[model samples]
Target chain A: MTGPHKERAVTHTRLDVLRLPLIGLLRRRWGRLALQIPLLAAAVLLVIDGFTGPQMAARNLATVAPWVHFRGFVVLVLLLAGNLFCMGCPFTLPRTLAKRLSIRGRRFPRRLRNKWVAIASLFLLFVTYEALDLWASPALTAWLIVAYFAASFVLEAVFTESAFCKYVCPLGTFNFVYSTISPTQIGIHDPEVCRACVGKECINGSYSPTPLVRLDDIPGGQCEVRHGPEGTPGCGTLLFAPQIESNLDCTMCLDCARACPHNNVGLFVRQPGRELLRPEAWPKRWDVSLLAISLAALGLVNAFGMVPPVYELQRALIKTLGIQSEWLMIGLIFGVGGLLLPFALALLAGALSRALARKKLSLRHTVAAFAPAFVPLGFGIWFAHYGFHFLIAPLTIIPVIQEFLGQPGDWAAFSSTADAVLIGLVQGAGLVLGFLWSLALANRTAARLYRRDAVPGLLPWALLLLALAFAAGYVFSLPMEMRGSLLMG
Target chain B: MSFFRLIAVGLLLLAAAGCRGQAITPTPAEKLSIEMAVEPDPARVGEAALIVTLTGANGQPVDGAKIGARGDMSHAGMAPVLAEAEGGQDGRYRIPFEWTMSGDWFVELTITLPDGSTMTQRFDVSVSGAGS
Candidate 1:
């Protein structure tokens, strides 16, 4: 890979880059919180619309929430820009305001750093969702919105800094993973410029209440990216720009680049798909384990809403357990999904690791490597579930809402089941496509690390397909009585 | 030989069994019917009490069924009060229609079946003003 580029590598020092005109604009001191205003407004509209606007029971419009459409578009924008979503995520608004704007709040303790717990809790969330019909119930859906706000506020209060968005948010994880396929990344143009810099203000909280940097002190205040201040912590997120293998941990706050004295960091487009191959640095076994389990749970939850039996089981379980629905549901979720599924996955991956590696690695390492393969399976399943909603639902949601609200409205309903079936087929096709794409990506990564072909490493793939096929059958067996009712009259 | 392989094998076997459990064949167009239930009130409709039952082919209760009907009392000299109820245990369904000074009142049931299928049925009955 090293060639003419290495020969032409200018290796510009900190003093030279600081004086450059172009580097100045790239590391400007303006806080990008301005970017989040539109996103916050959209989230507010989604909340209100879920309550006062009209019940999504209308079937069609209910499938595609205003938030999902907005989420996809925002992630697209983030993919184009550098960690723009983190810069302006509304989930972080409360924390930013509290620390910088308010003086009365207590500082969040560091010992309480419980990202793994948060990740596990999120995994348990999807499990509980599986055992319940929250997705089918408009009432529960409304409460989920309230829960997001509550969790964000409390986490911000209990933990100082952007703890919730950085370590806890599932949507943040989703954004980070999907953003891997994104063409843009945050990187440094000159490492020499970064090394000579003093007073790394970007991470040290030296800049204004925000990350904006002044032109006169551009180079010195810049973020050290990978490292923080000599003694103090640099890059609270621990992302080192000069040595960053991938854009995985980058929040794209631009604080590091903005705070640098030499204007060292630059958001560059060196290669189109290089980040996909880079191995993860922070090997948190528990984090990887939870994510693998979460990926499976996400597919099940997405498919669960479409199945009639799932709802029936949910109602029966609630009646039988005789517990408050939420607690019962949460317990069932953790018991089955969080605990059982991962145990099953770990066992499966361990066997494969032993089979292929010819040596006994700890269950942790086996599970982590096996976890990436499941990513494809998860993406495939998501495509199958959401793809159908994305296509056929727009046609029916309007009229359904109008009919329920007793108001006259303009909307087209599905003329036949064949139409619905066609949509399902399209969704199935998407799942297949995603499956293949992930398989290829996983193979490449596995081969690079494992040093042989990845084809033999496809045992997990076969298992995922079997699981997904079962899920599809369950969907088909749904009382399916509600199929036509989704259309507005 | 390993624990993980055992779980995978077990889940796969379970899934295979589920796949073999039951196969539901589609009923014929005529035999497949959706029924709606109505709460019966004898006092409101005069002595001519006839339960309005909507069916396709075989008597299958079609949930999520849609129906529309009106009483044709001009021909019978007395009208009957017809009403529909949410489907219940006995698989009976209902719709509301008023049988006025009746001769013969005709009822129509337009139903959208559970499987995204649609079927319509109609019933006609003779009515008299309390035999006066």
Candidate 2:
């Protein structure tokens, strides 16, 4: 008290969720399981209902939960919060057990460590989902869940770290990419604290000479004193707490927080899409940039598949080319429209951005820099499309669970016409706001790179983003065709 | 901790064993043609009726048939309008249906004859007219 430095109590900003009493539970080693267990139970119930309950998709818990509720909620939560789904993921429920069994397991192949594999997985997932019409079939939905668990287990069994989540899982990749726009992220309270510490327990993990006791080089820090249960696993994604710049690969697992002896790691809050403005945060790697571009394109293509007009388009394709199989038609649409066209657009946009620049910038680098700009519009499309469906029949899940439980409640009773206008308005606002956000991202990114020439540099992407936004509005204007409920075309 | 994970994985496999698709039972061959017409053509999104007519290969009307009609939207997860109808004169089954929300819909019919045999047919119905 007599010294020049006065006693300063440890405090957190208003938005730091880590400081919240209830959410602070996430700092515990068992926090993830608390959320995961219920989801695991729900998954089990769905699989059981999928196989044994009614085959009709609307009447089935397995189909409705995954295709409707899960998809809708995932996007909503990603936009509102961080990667909480990844935090509470049930697919990796056996991860700890798998890792225990494969203690000395081989590393993932050096060459296969990137987003490209995940990109391909996303394509495969979306294509199969649309081609097979997985939404309508409860049996298929159950099988999908089984396949997810099997894949997660097999990868965890054979390789070290989160190979499935980082490189293979489509949902994980989607969540990881969109979650960059989420409000919260794992961050250290002070860089000087982490720099001065030796254990580096956030990423390296905290272990003890014995179980059920606090153990560390640093005496009395966050994890041991506040979090308790000091010994915890390290970051599975290999993200160092201090070095982590964005939400790209962070699963929101909070392992870093639990393992941090300093309790320096905080789930801090920041503006959504603020990361998109930092082009330096995202490397100029081709896969990193192309993934964002293609995802935005994929959102448009996926939404297109659900509109009634698409059936007419499919019919025309069948007639013109004598395409016998609907699968073949769906495949062509996904391959060309979903995958190829996006790259083609990127080449055009990147080339134009390069050409228009006062300074000669590499076409690839320009493309990569502008790639983050796609996240908002792409995320918007997904959020709006998924959010609309979710809001339209948010409570329909109640009757579905009831029916599966042998109650057979009325589903139509939950339906409402009053909210349609409001939902539609919110959806429109989401789209427009997404468009404005993407433009701002492009402007900010280009402003940093080109400064005075930012407008000319970003003109191509702006036009492209505008067209994408316009296309999204047009498709949304068309009546949404409900898939899986009707007979196969 | 791994024990809990192991149990979760085991339950996953247990769930998988129950997921074989519904078996398709072969029905006896029958010569029946099916057709449907919507009252108030260009079906608007509101109260409606499906005039389903069943005719045999001999071109004679099939009567006393019980039709269980379920109208589903083309999209998944929306509630289906479930209604039942007994066949009337000329094998015409007047099935009462409400188009709650309109874009595209398909009505699946499970026709049970008086003889206690059931056959299924699906018809895609497009209601371009818009409403909640």
Candidate 3:
């Protein structure tokens, strides 16, 4: 097994984002707090608007900003950067203040540490959005924002670290899943420094009974050694820089960077989806596998909900089943599309792989190990769906701002046919790129697992990936409903 | 802290506070209520009749109002279908519009009252199969 130092030395080729002068500013003590203030203000406005503004979904800031603008931007950012939205999330700002007042520092429940709760939460979020027509209701969307704040505050006040972000938040789970492919990750600048250091400050924040003086107050702004009652802080997630693996649990809060006494932690740029290839970084677990598979299925379900065929299918099902409740119809569609379909596909792939490899691997273990291969295609579908909304009405934000100020402006001109075609091309490219990358990953996994004769093992997974990609490609080709903005009409 | 330092900190706090503007609540005089119905419920993907009954304060239907309506897909970037209707029997206004495609559509109505006050309301319309 490679030691932490060897891992660091090998991974040193990654560009250190903190080395940049601007990003380094975030390493300061108040850096995150400073960035959060404006976002918190925006959240406050959104909640207020939701309660007081016009009931129309498009005419209010409450609905447009979150559903239209925020969802679009989150996916785009995940594609390009690391989890920057989490870094700027305002939901946790209240928790920060509450912790300062009185913190119990309780640990999250041991039994509930897995991603099952989070996966369930994510599924519920998807179901509710469709069933309740959440995007069409400004007041409900506003309350969702309020509920997020309440949950974050209460959970963080009870627990010591970011329990909401790490264990419970559905949005965080979405970020965690998609961010597996993000190009940047927080890691150690030098593993040697961490190995020699006495205090592991990154995971544990610098603690003192009394308020510690800022290092800037001293002759030199930087401290050469750890001293005084104040101890350097550490990663809130308890991840040691040298041992930290993928972007799965990382919120990119940079607490580690600020807390490292030896200045070992730095945000590094690596190949996108590099973590998917590294099994050692994150051990294969049932929950994460289930999450990945569910995400893949939900990606299709999300896209299909917007297209014509699903609507037609729903109508046919309703007629045949004589289902009186529209909610039951929606429930059936989501259950089959999101849950049953993907689970069946994954089990089939695992069985095929086990049979082909001639190995004695447990079906569950094999499925868990190979589930990460589907992340790229899942992320591709999300990108295409959200990206379409973003590109088509990037300027929807303008009218929202105007309406908030009591001067509702005319809706901007609709995007040109050429623009729509260009977006479709980009979406197609995302699907193709994801397919190719997933194929490479599947092959690599096969080679690692089966050795010498990996091609036979790879074939089943390759076919599954191909089917997913083609389905996504077809969905992208269809005319989708752009539901969140008033600008369209 | 020095006077200048205090002022600087105060300015920073003020700037942060200014990020969110105050919420504006419409007064009773500014509030307009509207009720709408789309015929051929689950209006097929073609021409459908839209009936709107505009009301002012006290739940009274506002008669002699001029109405203009525009319909398009809920998502941005589609050509809009525009229609105009005059107030009819009992303050009911009727406008016939084509759905064009089967999906979620929003019909936005702008009503100009007899007093010349204009108010707007949006209705969500779901259209299914192609028209007969």
Q: Which segments of model 3 are wrong by more than 4 Å? A: A12-14, A101-103, A211-233, A315-328, A413-418, A482-489, B1-68, B72-101, B111-124, B128-132
What lDDT tens digits, residue by residue, belong to model 2 across residues A58-171? Answer: 778888888888998899899898899999998887677685575637778988888889989998988788877788788888899889999999887788778898889999
lDDT of 3 by residue, A145-237 (tens): 889989898998888767888889999999988899998888876565666555566776666666554432122244454434334445656
For DockQ, candidate 1 versus 3, the one ahead is 3
DockQ of each: 0.02, 0.24, 0.17
Place model 1 in a CAPRI quality band: incorrect
Stretches of candidate 2 off by over 4 Å are: A1-14, A207-230, A319-322, A483-488, B1-37, B40-47, B52-69, B82-93, B100-132
Candidates sorted by TM-score, best first: 2, 3, 1
Model 2 lDDT tens row, B18-130: 54345445363277778889876778778899898989889999999888787877455676788889957888989888877666677888887877777888887777555
For each candidate, what TM-score against the reference? 0.60, 0.84, 0.83
TM-score for chain B considered on its own, for each of the candidates: 0.45, 0.81, 0.71
Evaluation by lDDT, superior candidate among 2 and 3: 2
Residue B117's lDDT in candidate 2: 70
Q: What is the C-alpha RMSD of each candidate to the true structure, in Å?
A: 17.1, 5.8, 6.0
lDDT of 2 at A289: 85
Model 3 chain A weakest 10-residue run by lDDT: A213-222
Q: Which stretches of candidate 1 lie over 4 Å from their true place?
A: A1-31, A59-88, A101-115, A127-143, A205-238, A247-249, A253-263, A266-276, A280-284, A309-335, A395-408, A412-422, A441-489, B1-132
